[model samples]
Target: MHERVATTPSLMIKRRLNATPAEVFEAWTDAKLLMQWFGPENVVTQEVSVDAQVGGGFRVVMRENTGERHEVRGTYSEVVANEKLVFSWSWITTPERVSRVSVTFKPDGAAGTILTLLHEQLFDEQAVKGHTHGWTGSLAKLEALFA
Candidate 1:
C-alpha cells in the first residue's frame, strides 16, 4: 500500500500605498478598480465581477499577451470595511486546489496605508512561489494607481 503525503505552503506580502485605508479597500472591493490592477503586469484583465460582502463571490478573467486566458473565482469569507478581507480562492481550471487569502489594511500615519496579504493552504511549494510572484507584480500595479 502507498501512503500519500500532502504539503501546504503559504506566502505573505506587505505593501505601502500612498492612499488611505478606505481607498485601498475600495480598490479591492470595486470591480472596476480591481480589474485595473488585479493581474500580473503582462496580463490584461478581460472581465471582472465582484459582490463585495461576506459570503459574496468574485470572478476575474485575464488574458495573457499570448492570448491565453486564465480565470479565477472566489467567495468572500469575511469582510470588514477599510480593515480586512478574507476569501477563498481557486482557479476555475483547478478548483480542487483551493486556497485562502486574507488582506489587512491599516493607516500608515496620515498619508498612506499599510497593506498586508497572506495567502495560505496552497497545494505545494510551487504554488507558493507562483502566487508570490503574481502578487508582487499585481501589487506594483496597485501602487501605480496611487502614484
Candidate 2:
C-alpha cells in the first residue's frame, strides 16, 4: 500500500491594499496584472496565465537574478468575483507535493481593501517558512503597485 503523506501547516497573510476590492481581485486573477507582481524581490515573473474560473487552471514561471527558475501551476477550485479564490498549488519539480491557496478580498471603506491569503497543505514546517518569506517579499511588490 502507498503511504499517505499528511498535509498540515499553513501560511497566512493579511494586508490592507490601497486599491478597491475589484482592482485587487483583478490584480490576482488577471495574467497581465499578476505578472507585474508575482514573485519575490529578487525574482522576476517570466510567464503567467490565469484562467480565473472554477475548474480553470493557472501557471507561473519566475526567474531569479542568479538564473534560477521556478514554475508552479494549479487548478482553481473556487472563484468568487472580487471576494474569494481557492486553488490548488504545486511546483513543477514536485507535483506530488500539492497544496492549496485561498485569497479573500474584503471592503474596508476608507482603507480600500483588506486582502487575506491563506496557503495550506504545506509539506512541512520548512515549506511553511519558505513560503512565508516568498509571499512576504512578493506582497511587498504587490503593495507598492498601488502605493
Candidate 3:
C-alpha cells in the first residue's frame, strides 16, 4: 500500500513602492494598470473577467512567448481600502495548486508605500523558489510603472 504524502510550499515577497498606498492599491484593482506589470517579460495576461469587489471573482489567461497559455482564477476574500487584500487563488492547469495570498499596503515614513505580500500553500521547495523569483521580478515591473 502506498503511504499518504503531503506537499505544501509557500513564498513571501515584500516590496516598497515610491508611491502612496492608494496608488499601489489602485494598480492592483485596476485591470488596465495590472496588465502593465503582472507577468514575465515574454508573458502577457489577457484578463477575461475581473470583479474587484469582495467575494467577486477574476480570471486571466497568461500567454507565454511560445503561445502556451495558463489560466488563473481567484476570488477576493477580503479587501480594505488602501490597506490590505486577501484572496484565494489557484491555477487551472494545476489542480492542486491552491493558495491564499495576503497583501498589505502601509505608508512609509517618508513619502512611499510599503507593500507586503504573503503567499501561502505552495506545493514544494522548488515551487517556492521559482515563485519567489517570479514575484520579485513582477514587483520590479510594477515599480517601473510607478517610476
TM-score of each: 0.94, 0.94, 0.87
Per the 3 Å backbone cut-off, how many clashing residue pairs does candidate 3 have?
Answer: 1
**Candidate 2 TM-score over all chains jointly:** 0.94
Report the C-alpha lDDT of model 1 over 27-53, residue by residue, as the tens digit: 999999999999987899989999989
Candidate 2 lDDT over 79-142, as tens digits, reads 9999999999999999999999999999999659999999999999999998999899988988
Which clashing pairs does model 3 show?
Answer: 9-122
lDDT of 2 at 3: 100
How does model 3 score by TM-score?
A: 0.87
Candidates' C-alpha lDDT: 0.94, 0.94, 0.82
Cα deviation of 49, candidate 1, in Å = 0.6
lDDT for model 1 comes to 0.94
Candidate 3 stretches greater than 4 Å from native: 1-7
Sorted on TM-score, best first, the list reads 1, 2, 3
